[model samples]
Target: MQYQAPVDDMMFLVKDVFSLTERLGDIADFADFDEDLYAAILEEAGKFATGVLQPINRSGDEEGCQYNDGVVTTPKGFKEAYQAYVEGGWQSITADPNYGGQGLPKALHVLIEEMFYSANTSFCLYGSLTGGATQLLQAHADEATKQKYLPNLISGQWSGSMCLTEAHAGSDLGLLKTKAEPNDDGSYSLEGSKIFITGGEHDMAENIIHLVLARLPDAPAGPKGISLFLVPKFMVNDDGSLGERNGIECGSIEHKMGIKASSTCVMNMDDAKGWLIGPPHQGLRCMFTMMNLERLSIGIQGIGLGEMAFQQADAYARDRLQGRANDGEAPAALIKHGDVQRMLNTMESFNKAGRALGVWLGSYLDETFHSKDQSKVKTADIMSAWLTPIAKAYFTDAGYETCTIGQQVFGGHGYVREWGMEQHVRDCRIAQIYEGTNGIQALDLIGRKLIGSKGEYLKVFLSEVNSDLVTMPDSAHKNQVSELLTELEQLSETIISRSASNSEIPQLVACDYLHYVALVTYSYLWLKMEVAAQGKLDQQSAFFFKRILTRTLGLKASIESEL
Candidate 1:
């Protein structure tokens, strides 16, 4: 199957739905963005993804990564793809220009990532993890750390990984037992192991940077005592040259169900030479900066895979001859059947809504942090926090389901390996499992974003949703969004009252509640897109409203019913 980047819709969301040309044009950094530059960037990104990455996707997966004598080698062509990626300056899209980046909008970077991820997820991990590390180091790392690491990472000379999960620790980082001891030179000795470390040890880069979480000997136990450190694979000399290998080493690469080409490893930090990024015993706070970005990136992985699945399924349905259409016309292919249309429609609705949500949220997030205006900053922050978990859990869940449904369109052929549809299914499955599993995302949504803030964040979200509906010109989706808003309001009250007596109520209802929030958020985005598209998207918008958006009513009943 061949992959084609959905450049049109991506451009539409950025230029139309978000009103980028108008809203962002006033911003000094985005003032000079022109049509030619925009087209060139997307065209080149799509070309690179298809020409460089897509060719190796299935081949790399079959080859997987190799582990020998504690050395890890990614599948054939993987390293070359990364080299092209860096040489093309793809990693600098959202980086600070001073550090050798183009400094494009992060949301725009998300659009570019969808293409790369859709083309080859394994090859794409190297770039995304490196960008995540850049964010961490820029935000929390000292000036010296930033200077030493940002340029190389931004230029993609080295890759990075987050080393938080130990054998005993998964979502509950507090249970981790990794220890960090103070050294005479103000560095620390980190001794323990981290598992499921993505691209933790790979041969593609000259160096590997690990953002590890460990605790001091006298620090308090659990999450509060944890500290974040930067443990590089090789020490750097005073003259910026590579020094001897550091204490970190890859024990072995994991044999995984999917994204097999990407090296997931068992990382051993045996008295690793490391430098602290932020204040001591305040690691969790700094880690969230990276973790939140990873969470959103994982969600986009789902959307990327969904797009790939949709393309493959849609193409196969049109070309593969099957039963005749029930409609009067003599149909030659399966796509003529109503069931086939229904399947495609389901995939299309969620993918469209999910992708739009991701891009818009990314745009809003950039504004939240970068805008000089105080009022815009405050508004964007609220929406960013509210949508972070939704983007993570909802998109991945929907993306996985989309891929499966797309596979169903192929019937038995979808199950066959040679068809390549099964690979998308396998590759997408891990998104829901990794990056703080979808279940934990639900808990984070309700327990942290909604309730932990004492309903402050939800109020902001509701206000914005209501504002969007009111401002949107009259349309079918507008009323549906209104209904969704009202349903969410009632559901929130139900959850609040129920949780008053039993705090565990969130755990019981978070899964359902998360779906409720996701459906509403997606519906709102559809309505917004429909309004912005000036009726071009009416069909897709209605498909979501009638087919999937109706689920919230049942969710409300589930949330309120005696359990």
Candidate 2:
């Protein structure tokens, strides 16, 4: 079966819930953006996805990536297709315009990402990593560094990688052994081995620009001592031409269960030529600038996979002939059976909630970037920070389950290789593990976000939701809204209060707490979406609206059961 982009739902969320085109400030660069252009962009993105990228997703997975000696080769067609993506201007959508980027709002890019991710996750990772690496450099790198690297990265002429993890130092950066020594020329010589570096050694571009994390001499112990450096695979001249090899080599690439098309290489940096980003001993802080972007981007990845899985399952259920309906109307496809319909309905609604949350977070980031109002910007910042971990962990966690349920719709065929449903499950499984394992994300949420600064962030989130609930008028959603708000508030208070006494309390309940927040957040967004859809409901829109409300109501039961 072919994949179809959920255009109507995506546009509705962007236009109504996000208002990206309508509410963007008078930022000089964004002044020309309008609804029609935004729609056209999304339409073209969908076409590129369905026509160009989706056709190769399964093949990429089947072929995976290959390594000969130290050189890595992506699956057949990846290099050419990636070049096409670059020519299409996708690599620069949200990058700095001064560096050959289009400088568009991230909300628009969010739609593009969903399609790109859905079309081919492994392929999209190469481009996404470059965008993320470029964001880090643009924000923190020096003039010489930026002048040399940014344009190529933004143009996708060269790709990029983040070298953060070692075999022993995955999340605990304080334990890392990569070293950087100062040279007379004010540059650094970096020597280290990094594991699980996505896009580290692929031959998809002219060069691979690596943003590596290393500890300098005489630095303090622990994470405070770590610093970031721009270490390219090949040295570049003043005119941005390629020079000699920079001593960074792919020792080997990982054999992974999913996203096999994207090389996860073990990189060895032996006295590599490097330039530092940001101040000494403040690398982690600068790294967060890129990580925060990638974290949310990863969440969107999970949401996209879920959306695609739901689409695939819904299409399969509609066409696959199976048992008779419980109502005894007639023998029909699996979709006509009540149990199967319930599962598809559940999958559909969950994907909607995930998309709404994902896009809403994207909207929040857009507002954070463009809003002139300080209070709004600050509010958006706090919300974005507080919700970042939840968004990444919960969405991915749910995405795994959603994909599994999607495969269930295909039964035996789903378990087999040819069907491609299993690929969604395999690719999505790693999201929960990487980007700081979901457990780490949960710990960060409750430890740093919820209880940090004496529960200030959680208070801000709950308070805002509470305030929103008051304006919800006397519709059928009112009671549901009020109940959900109350439940979430109680959970927040319970976790916050208990975590104060025991250090382990937060960790113990964090996964559950994350689920609680996600369920409630979806409930809240469902209320908002239903309200938005009312004024603009066409035939299909009305049906979708009703389904969203039903799903929101059903979630109350699921969440309550967890409690």
Candidate 3:
């Protein structure tokens, strides 16, 4: 299967659907970006994603990454593909201009990212994780560290990895056993092991920067004692050249279900020289900066794979002819069948809605980080805090569902290894599992986001949705969108009230609550998308009717019954 970047759809969402250029025109940082520049950047990125990286997606999945001794080798073409990514400056698209980056808007970055993920999920991780580390260093690392490390990562000269999980600790970072001992020269020496560390060791970049989580000897117990450390695989000399290999080593890489070309290593750190990035005993909070971004990236990854799978299935359905149509036409294409239409429609709906939501959130991130308006910035922060988990879980869940549907479109061929649909289904499954499981996301939604703040954040979000509803002209879709918002508010009240006494009610209903919220939010976007379309009818009505809005009643029943 050949992968083509859906630049038109993305451009539609960027220029027309979102009107991002007009919205950001007042922000000095973003004022210079025009449609022509956005198009040129997107065109080049599409070329790299489609022409360079995508060609190796299937081949890389088949060959996987090789591990010999402690060294990890990516698939044959991955290193070169990544090098091209660096040379083209794709890795630094949204990086700070002070550090060799183009300083582009993150919304544009998200669009380019989808192409990378859709074209090749495994190859995208090497840069994505590095970008996460670079973002963290830019935010918290001292001027010295920033000057030394940020440029390399921003330039893609060296890749970056975050080491947080240990054998004993997965989601619960407070229980991690990694130890960090303070040295005389104001650095820390970390000694412990980390598991499931993505890009922990790879042959693509010159050096690997590991942003690790460890506890100082005198540090208190639990998450409060945790501190983040900058541990590099190879130490840097005073002259900015590579020094001796550091204590960190890749013990082995896991044989995984998918994304095999990306290295997931068991990292052993023995007296690894590490420097503290943020304040002591604040590792978890510091990591959250990266964590929040990763959640969004992973969500985009989900949609990207979904988008890819949909393309493959659509192509296969249109080309592959088999049974007769219901109208007695012989040898009809699979696309003519109603069931096939349903499947394709469902996937397309997910892709459009998912892309819109991701870009919307990315725009908010731009506001949160760059905008001068304090009120807007505060609202963006809270909105991001509540929606991060939802975006993380909902997008991944949608991705997995869409991929499976695409696979099913192939019937027997989907089960076989003939096409790329099966691989997408497998690769997308991990998004929901890692970066905190979807279940964890649900827990966060109800426990922390809903219950912790006494529903103030949820109320703020509801008001935001309500504000959007006012501009939308009166129609069934608009009415339904309003009603769903109210119903969700009432349902949230029920969950909050019931959980006050039952305690287990939140857990029992968190997943459903998450889904209910996801449907409502997505429908809100569909309404805006409709407005963006000037109320014209198209395939989007298919998704709005069946996939999202129609589910409102059933969700109401489920949520109320749970309460």
Residue pairs that clash (backbone atoms under 3 angstroms), model 1: none
Any residue pairs clashing in model 2, and if so which?
Answer: none
User: Taking the tens digit of each residue's C-alpha lDDT, what string does model 3 give over 190-254?
Assistant: 99999999999989999999999999988888989999999999998767899999999999999
TM-scores for all predictions: 0.98, 0.94, 0.98
Of candidate 3, the 10-residue stretch with the lowest lDDT total is: 535-544
Q: What lDDT score is found at residue 527 in candidate 2?
A: 71
- When 1 and 2 are scored with lDDT, the better candidate is 1
- Model 2, span 1-563: residue lDDT tens: 77788787888887876576655755556888887788888898998888889888998898989999999988888888988898998898988788898888887787788788888888888888888899888879888788889999999999999889999977998999999999999889999899999999987899999999999998899999999998888889887789999989999999998999989999998889898899999999999877888887787778788888888888888888786777774558888887777667667666777777777777677667767778878877888888889888987888888889899999999999888899999999998988788888888887888778567887777777778777665665557667766766676676667666766777667776677677667767777777778755333333444554444445445434533
Residue 401 alpha-carbon offset, candidate 3, angstroms: 0.9
Error of 1 at 10 (Å): 1.0
Candidate 3 local Cα displacement, residue 216, angstroms: 0.8
Evaluated at residue 397, the lDDT of candidate 1 is: 89
